[model samples]
Target: MSQTIAVLDFGSQYTQVIARRIRECNIYSRIFPYSVTAAELRKANVSGIILSGGPSSVLTKGSPRPDKKIFQLGVPVLGICYGLQLMGKLLGGDVAKSDRREYGRGRLTIKKKGRLLKGLPKSIKVWNSHGDKVTALPEGFEPIAGTENSDYAVIEDATRNFYGLQFHPEVVHSERGDDIIKNFLVGVCKCKQDWKMSNYVDQAIQDIRDQVGDSRVILGLSGGVDSSVAAALIHRAIGDQLTCVFVDNGLLRLRERDRVEQVFRDHFHVDLRVAKSGKRFLKALKGVTDPERKRKIIGKIFVDVFEDTVKKIGDVDFLAQGTLYPDVIESVAIDGNPAALIKSHHNVGGLPKRMKLKLLEPFRELFKDEVRALGKELGLPDEMIWRHPFPGPGLGVRVMGEIKKSYLDTLREADAILLEEMKRTGYYSKVWQAFCVFLPVQTVGVMGDERTYDYVIALRVVESVDAMTADWAHIPHDILQIISNRIINEVKGVNRVVLDISSKPPSTIEWE
Candidate 1:
């Protein structure tokens, strides 16, 4: 943690990806607003600065721009996309809208093996998503690489240790992206690779102890990686001072309550209280069909029920959640830029309002994979650590249209079958999320010579590094056939099963 790389966010969706890439190199990194001053960065003791790409055009007036003094900070500065254009504009160079905008894959031909492009090939594939390009290089700047459309795709001022790229190297679609980032971190910035998950664990435990001195903490343990790890870490820091509440909301998957009870209560010996409030949640959710309405209803009811349970459990000082960085970034607009709010996280800002308790979120700065690693480091079993992410609204969102007792039962059974077959076929751990979305529409089918109309289940299985982007997982036809057959026959769900073959852009992983 001694040497840090600071990423300046300009409302880019891939801003977190840049931070994640730096962390993957065992170098600590943090994100700041585009308005962060050089004095602030100097106080942060940043070894290098990375300007993130955004959906902004540098040619537009009032577009997002960083403090001009950052160029004088003397740290190695790497600008990307809009960042690159911003640099060219601010540093006495010309930036204009490209006649041929590069939005997808492009080839970068290295003109010089500068320190920023050290060890890279003469030509490499890159992922581009920019409309503006640097037309003229600033003083003391030279082009190190060029794409077919962008003559100054990569520009560098070696004297000032400033570099720019018109393409994003943090995305996986870019070949050798990690190497380019590594070159910047180790080759140019000279960052010490000393950060580790073990260091984070030790630091987090001590931080929890410091933050909650002699105060009892209450955690809503959903048995997911984030909460589970938070519980384990907090419990390790202050034994018996943590009380975990697992609410059976009638919308969870098959036997989720039992699994949670066994793992936390029986195995881990956590102070877990199960509030058998399934009927209450179901009643509140009855006749609700809109996804947003379902989420809000469930969140409000959960907070109400959770607060009631807390009243019975005695006085609590703090409320803990397993909120990760994506949730934080998505909820809050980056410096009031045009990132736009995606959705409010149920575990983030909801409970704190009604409960009126101090919030404790240890994983707020962490990513999903980082939380899983922390869970594993904290001695959580592989099954729980690698569990596919479940929506905060639980199966409430998964059961698409209305909330009904019979629909819940049917969806739960069908989802369980899908998971069972996935595990059997070794596809469970292979995908990021695998679930069944219960479609309210019924279809005609012939079952045992009887014409019947029943519910249809849409199977969504996606592969993703981060939930920001995902592609449908390509399970073999044979395995899919087995899953479809099992769900149709073993589970009493109505007739048909369909696979979602769409990617993330046009279609989301969830139907609703």
Candidate 2:
């Protein structure tokens, strides 16, 4: 087995982020409950252990902590934020509530360039989000770096191969954050960078084969990257044992169904079944203005279509989905550690239990980029692999408020035009996600020689390393003008186009 870096979750929201950072360094990392015993860590042969930051303070009576025996395991250990305070308290140091809580950027002044702070700069900025600080070091520990508010910003026990950081280096806001993590993972832990996408691909195939010996697997194929990639990988593994059911809910992007058919059916020669249920979905969504209701209607229609399709194809043993790690991480409530559930996702939504089929999520532990890499290894086309994320409700959410066939048709055309212009100007790949929204209210405008009233289109484009947070993309005025002009002239929709310049916290990427 390959050596692993075990990140013990203390309910920090960035726990998954830390795991991703480790994976980006070509090192395998897995998140475990904070209560994971030392024997379990030894059994897994972890090269290093990372204690994630949490909301609770170590001074609290019922705060989470790891096994005391972990210190004796002899592997390199790094604690972050709340983890740092816990480390101090457990190791015979003083940890108290800070007079001034450091919740944002702080300048780190390096006192000693230790292995954890193994760089040339004397000062660097780091993101700090902590309410408590380590006031005094343990017997064998020394302060390697400090910020203005906290004297022990970075502490290390060189004799024990243990380190702690008051700031969060897992986040992108911290300068040279990746380098800091690399130092701990590579230098201190001595982890060989053997983790790669190719290795995952080979292992996933064998695991799939082993799990699904003679069982038939049915996957609900959404043309989006995740499901498409999942379908491709499952097909590559089981060959004729997989059947992909593509449901056309009449709310997808322009030519999305055709693209799925061409890629999975024509190119890969997999068993593809296309369910043309556009009318069913549009009928069910008629006059539904509430976003939640629209989602419910779409989801119900999808399940109906999927069940009907699967019934005709006969019984399948397993239902496969392209559930990535982000989805799983969002819903992880690890042992009362106060990790919030960012969102709830059931890729197929209770279908496995209702239909009595085993759930097969091969990419459940993999991230989005990793899935794309896996897709590439499975020989999927670039367009499919690099496609932006699409909401489960599809264009249903893009057409804000009311659900009408005319609205969907207009939205699809406008969105297609927007994407075409984005790709033409080489802006599609530059931005994380770019799509157009169809406003429910119509605006009056003069077209050619006549006055007309039509719907308005809103363009939403953002730049982000992860969809957790996003900033509006500053596409050049020329490209925006081109996209706006094309939507108005080519698509039989609104004459007016507007840009959304709001960031993620204040506004979401999708209008609905």
Best model per lDDT? 1
Clashing pairs in 2: none
- Best candidate, TM-score: 1
Q: Which sections of candidate 1 miss by over 4 Å?
A: 59-62, 209-215, 310-317, 328-338, 349-355
Model 1, 1-512: lDDT tens digits are: 56889999888888889999998999988888899889999998999999999888888888888999999989899999988899999999998888998989999999898788888889999999988889999999999899999899999999999999999999998988899999999999999888988988887888899999999899988988888888989999999999999988888888899889988887779889988888998988888888777878888888887799889989898888888877765664633655756666567554556577788888877888888988889888898889998877888888877888898899989988899889988999999999998888889998898987888998999998777788999999999998888888877856999988999866766665
**What pairs collide in candidate 1?**
none
lDDT of 2 by residue, 1-512 (tens): 57799999888878888998998899888878899999999998999999999988898998888898998999999999988888899989999899999998999999998888887489999999998999889899999889999989999999899999999999988998899999999999999988987877877888899999999999889888899888878888899999999888888888888888877777778788999998999888887897767766776677678778878999688888887666555553534546766544536335535667788888766767778888898888899888888887898888888788888889888888888888888889988899988887778999879998888899999997666678999999988988898889888868899999999766767776
Can you give the lDDT of residue 98 in candidate 2?
A: 94
RMSD, one per candidate, in order: 2.7, 3.0
The runs of at least 3 residues in candidate 2 whose Cα sits more than 4 Å from the true structure, single-residue gaps closed, are: 35-37, 56-69, 89-94, 136-139, 210-214, 283-315, 328-338, 343-352
C-alpha positional error of residue 124 in candidate 1 after TM-score superposition, expressed in Å: 2.1
